[model samples]
Target: MRPLNKGAKRQRVRRDPAPSRLFYRWQRIWLTPLYRRLISLGLPMAALVAGGHVLWSDPDVQAQVTASLVRARESVERRPEFQVQLIRLQDVPDDLATQIRQAANINLPISSFHLDLDEVKARIEEIDAVREVSLFLRAGGVLEVVIDQRIPVVIWRGAKQLEMLDAEGIRVGYLDHRTDRPDLPLLAGQGVGPHIGQALEILDAAHPVADRIRGLVRVGERRWDIVLDRGQRVMLPEDDAVRSVEHAMAMQMTQDVLSRDISVMDMRDARRSILRLSEAALEERRVQQAIAKDVDNNL
Candidate 1:
């Protein structure tokens, strides 16, 4: 073309577009549906994680945050609306009410949040006579405590002290002496605390002869021995001991056997009954036998 003189400029051919810059690629990706969704969801979570790491890295900051939270909580809890103004006790003796007061150790107009109901109940239950407790906050900001005390049924004398026990064999209180509570029956011996129910049953069965009763003694932690007046004893079998006492009472009514000079009436076998004569009765029997022998020889 006109011999296209050497070094003559030719028409430039258009080149295909080069790949976009990394920034443009990333920008395009950011506008995609998936990238937008990730940014929306992951950005807050990542920021929260980073902030938590920063917070936990400093102990002083963590403590300050905790203290601020606690102060806020306590400020709301100590409001007048949550204050306990009065305390009332139901079915409790003056002594126990005083004990409850002392155990609670709460000041008047104290906040309910400061009073741990469970802790108060446990403290009141520390009294040996307390069987059950019901606690609640009533109208007028009154904290009410209802007590169910254990009733003493028998006096247990052991472990070097005298103690009153309930029907369930729980120790109620320590006593100065047996006569302090004459109304309840007396029980004494080793390992008798757990068997007070059976002992009471035997006593109930022996009511007809109650006047002669000295007390009930536990033998070998298994059986019972009913001591009576005039140095007499009724030995009962370990099992079904109440039946033996009933039988003895019946015999006393009919034969007046307990009034006689007997040392022990053994009913341990249940199938048969044995009697041990006192020294005086045995001596008289010997004398009578000698007299009978001499008379027979003379005949």
Candidate 2:
């Protein structure tokens, strides 16, 4: 080899110390606060959720979990504190209490959780005699049922049967005979249920003839006909019906008009009172008229 010049030196290759582009980008994202937190917390949660889903997907596991939960619930519900030993009725007669038990149809020694109080209450209130009802569990494992019985205010004689009704015209119970409730005023004829208030007012005004009055008959569902014991009736108009009754009572008080031999006192016309005489009275009037006519002709 030829001798090299001292001024010409050999050159060496140099390498970069920084990381690659992909590794640099990944490192930057990993250093971020949100990404670091997510990486730390999310991975365990995701793994846990996936494991749970896999385990629950097995039918055997699902059955075991369901059975465990049911057993737990039963244990809690079957405790003495949740047990209903018996049902007690408050403000209910013995007969009605029996009826209530029949209506409730609940077996004894049931869990209070299993006893649907609302459904029991609804069944109890279905009775015609029950105005309202309340149900609750007493401290001594007794299911208490409180009842408000419908009080009968009047006796209604329907076309085919007789029934007792409350003040609101709701049927309370059926009657075997009119003598069953002699205290309540008797109401008859169609559409009388809705007009019970008006009928009651008329009855109140007829207190003077209460003993002689039999019942009130609704005429054509528009007016009232007060029937008396001795085949007598006071026909009242639709408007001012109570006032018409008052007028009849007034006449009875002053003139003893109800005691006369009149079949019907027609107060339908407000201006005048027309009296339909009895058959006997009509015959007597005809005979008298004939005698008077004969005497006048002879004169």
Candidate 3:
């Protein structure tokens, strides 16, 4: 091979560097391997979310989506697996259960998905007797309704009719006559329903005089008057009237105070006790006093 001269100009095989494939020049410096993976996943997801938001904003698209969902729901409801063949009720009287069933207004073999359980429960609970109600679909495709009936504690005599109330003072039912539930205690007067708690407490404290109790009479929407079987009444104080009743009961047990010919025993003043003598008793006392005076004068 012939040697080339040292002074000769050498032809350089210059190749062009490949152009950067990255869209943003900064990405080449800032984007790490993990960042590249995140970008690959997040960009498509963000695009899908943005597109969905835009589609949802359109009224026509919204209507179409709603219609599609409704159609899907209807199709699912038509299947036998979703159908309710029967309804069962627990903890309800026969008449009330029948009423609840009627109130449900549901057709047989109805789809559970189509039934609004909440509306059914609300409707059933609207009955004054139903204290609480729960509805659910059983495994056997029966719509089960469980009712908690309010237990009547006392019969309240209103202006027009008598009402049965629970211990919590919730009116549960109506009574044609107060004698229907003679076993239950009777309460009368305005605004007496809500104060059943205090009334019950007072009655309990007056248990010593239960046989003599006619009924409790609410006075001025506050305080109480324990009416005895005879024409006698024990007036109680406004505050802590239960204490007053208990005190009266204790006095009656020891002193037979209620057995005396007293028309009224006013214990309204906690500091002192007062009793009003009956007309007969007052006349007898006056006659005795007059006889004693005559004897002293003669002596």
Q: Name the top lDDT candidate.
A: 2
Question: Which candidate, 2 or 3, would have the higher TM-score against the true structure?
Answer: 2
Which of the two candidates, 1 or 2, achieves a greater lDDT against the reference? Answer: 2
Q: Give per-residue CA lDDT, model 1, range 1-299, as digits (tens).
A: 55857688877888977667987898788899998778888888899999999988899999999999999999999888899999998768887788778977888889898889999889889888899888999877999988899999998888789899998889998999888898898888888877888999999999988988888989888899998888889999999899998888888899988888999999898788999999999999999999999999999
TM-score of each: 0.75, 0.80, 0.69
Candidate 2 local distance difference test against the native? 0.90
Instruction: Quantify all predictions' global Cα lDDT against the true fold.
Output: 0.89, 0.90, 0.87
Tens digits of lDDT, candidate 3, 1-299 = 77668678878888876657774564763477776766787778999999999999999999999999999989988888989999998767888878888888898989887789889888888888888888889987888888889899988888899899998888988999877998888888888877898898988999988988878888999889889976899999999898999889889999999999999999999888899999999999999999999999999
Give the true-structure RMSD of model 3.
10.2
lDDT of 3 at 273: 82
Rank candidates, TM-score, best first: 2, 1, 3
* Regions of candidate 3 where Cα sits further than 4 Å from its true position: 1-78, 286-299
Lowest lDDT block of 10, candidate 1 = 1-10
Query: What residue pairs clash in candidate 1, if any at all?
Result: none
TM-score for candidate 1, residues paired by index: 0.75
Which pairs clash in model 3? none
Clashes of 3: 0
| Model 2 quality (TM-score) | 0.80
lDDT of 3 at 139: 82
